[model samples]
Target: GTDMGTARALRRNLEAGADSFPQDVVELMGYFQPAGDGQRIRAVPGEGEQVPIWILGSSLYGAQLAAMLGLPYAFASHFAPAELDHALEIYRSRFQPSKQLDKPYVMLGLNVFAAPSDAEARLLFTSLQQAFVNLRTGRPGRLPPPVEGYERDLDPMAKTMLGRALSCAVVGAPETVGQGIEAFVQRTGADELMVTAQIFDHAARVRSFEILADVHKSLSEAA
Candidate 1:
């Protein structure tokens, strides 16, 4: 997420040079609002190629801009679920359809972890969940080893939110996880799901995608 000048320059280069990239998709990070004079988003004058910019925000500001501009919006709900509902409501209610779309298109971030079994998935998730806890406690560290027990130690509220957040996540066994994710996609009506999975084992991380692909195939067959 660069400044407006950078964005404009990049677009210019892409337009002038090789046409390998798509200039229409300008994914903007809404968190980096300009600080002072000449720093505001006015840098992006909402013109030139009419770049389809999507305000990526974890709060309301992004939603407001998306609505005003009649553009799409993406929420970082995976890591920051606290403001999800409010952000979604603001974006939808204020949305004004543009020529590009008749309705607001919203996307949510999600953390996904897939494994052979529920027990194994939980074991693999320990490292990733611990990383989140570390971020919260300001003691960030590399993915740690899978601990023997964390589900039993976490508080009920924390556990509940984590479970809900991972409802379409950290699911185990291809069949079960596949069913869970299908249900999630159906219920959320999400056009796209951005997944961020954290696994301690590098090889295991690669395998997660393979498992996910298989699950997707299984679900499609069922449908």
Candidate 2:
């Protein structure tokens, strides 16, 4: 959630959330007492539910906080990957063991746009490219429909930014997607991968995941 405030205010809010998160969890698990009122509170259906909390981030702040709390960290590399390596290093090196987790666990975000043919997959990827460019150029709105040759129309700066931000994405046929997934995993050593796609057509979006699932099955069988 974007906080509408100054940097200091944002920091204060983050600190407050961090301090209260554990207490919230405890309250959800059963009992909590307000510091002021002499009353106990507990969530109705939430109490006694075993829920796991994972920290999601695209920067060092999230990594540091997750490490300090010994929670699993998920990097939003699908869109923002510039600080991924450094953030992972910091998290793993500084992790403190807690009751919930003992060792550092990392999940990486990846964009996969799979189709029957490479050209079709690339066409599907234009939607994401257009959306990203629109977002970076201060024209953020609902995701626009894909345009043919979207990158060709982009300015040099926009092109460069897109290349850098979407470097973690894989867009191609099954074979190409599989190879890209393998390369990304080998390079990052991520414990898990979170895949996302932003194809314009609903059927195409569904087909993309279907293709990815087949690719995953094939990879598993081969391994």
Candidate 3:
């Protein structure tokens, strides 16, 4: 749910019917403390060992808090990217060096669909396109099987919007995959990159990640 509609609202709604749902909401709140003392409690190290904590967000709020807390930051750019760069800038500039980390570390989330051929990769990518379109159209469900010419079906405006929203994504053959990852790294200088693929075909999905891993390894070696 959106930030405005937090666990409190869900808990309130569930109170009329089920008592257990409200308690579950309370437990969820303890685990998902975004602000206040509860958030600090989540950061506390247990026993003699140090605990590493990371703040996850697609907007500047998490970046600001992560900077203040001196924790690693992970941006959910794969879905929400409107504030990605701005959040990165805020995080790096306002970061306070902590005992656990000496400098700001940023991890960017990206989507990639890699295959032996560009056409094949694009066919695989249609699954994600369908899902995003479904979500935007208010009919989201388990990713339906890929539909050929799905982009053609969408009006020009949705196509443009999706292209912008998924700008961080990379979908292509081996050469294209290598170039895309290389360019992304050069552009963002991200400490780490997390790639996600939403493909309905299990075999194709595994191959997609395998291609990504091989491309990453080859790039690292050549570097």
Candidate 4:
């Protein structure tokens, strides 16, 4: 997510101040090739061991980099959906097959808040909407408890922005969530969907995922 310089600085700070840099930290980092300007690192993990490199992006810049590097691309559509299609198109068209992949593989990030009833799911989703609003308003904190009338309290601009940013979110009952998943997949042709369900209640979060699993299983069986 950051450049090599930032990663190096972070590692150094971790080791110097907190002693938190693990020995395998180098392998866990990702940076761009400096293009013959500086010392080039042959491999991150070193010793010729195969390491999977996935490019995570929220816009086209990341897509182009991943395509150039011939790595799988993951788009953060869960919060940045406006440029998703354009980024995917660029990545697929310019993809250079590497040893790891023969074709462009796209992973889409999404939010899923599934419940037995639409009303409950909508209530649960308020947590994420509120979080997003707080983030946009520069007051981000831990996922807060769901508040009644939270979405309604948001102004028109906030509502529109959240609607666009979280366009990939699927929040509803099992059937509605299933339909949303199918529609998103059809729209993006994503090879994988990485889901985040950010409900504050632990039991409800688990149940949400369980309901999603059941919905996906039923969809698969029907297909």
Highest TM-score against the true fold, candidate? 2
Stretches of model 2 off by over 4 angstroms after superposition: 1-41
lDDT of 4 by residue, 1-223 (tens): 3367667855665567324322223324333322233433334434245557788889888888778768899999998989999999999999989877889999999999999998899999999998998999999999989887888888899999889988889999999999999999998999899999999999999999999999989988999
Clashes of 1: 0
> Looking at model 4, which ten-residue stretch has the lowest summed lDDT?
18-27
Q: What is the number of residue pairs that collide in model 2? A: 0
**By the TM-score metric, which is better: model 1 or model 3?**
3
- lDDT ranking from best candidate downward: 2, 4, 3, 1
Flag regions of model 4 displaced more than 4 Å: 1-46
- What lDDT score belongs to each candidate, Candidate 1 first? 0.69, 0.85, 0.81, 0.83
Which stretch of 10 consecutive residues in model 1 shows the poorest summed lDDT? 22-31
- lDDT (Cα, 0-100) at 51 in candidate 4: 54
Clashes of each: 0, 0, 0, 0
lDDT of each residue in 32-137, candidate 2, tens digit only: 2223243233335544454566888999988987898888999999999999999999999999997779999999999999999999999899999988888877
Give the TM-scores of the predictions, in the order they appear.
0.70, 0.83, 0.79, 0.80
lDDT of 2 at 215: 96
CA error at residue 181 for candidate 2, angstroms: 0.5
Clashes of 4: 0
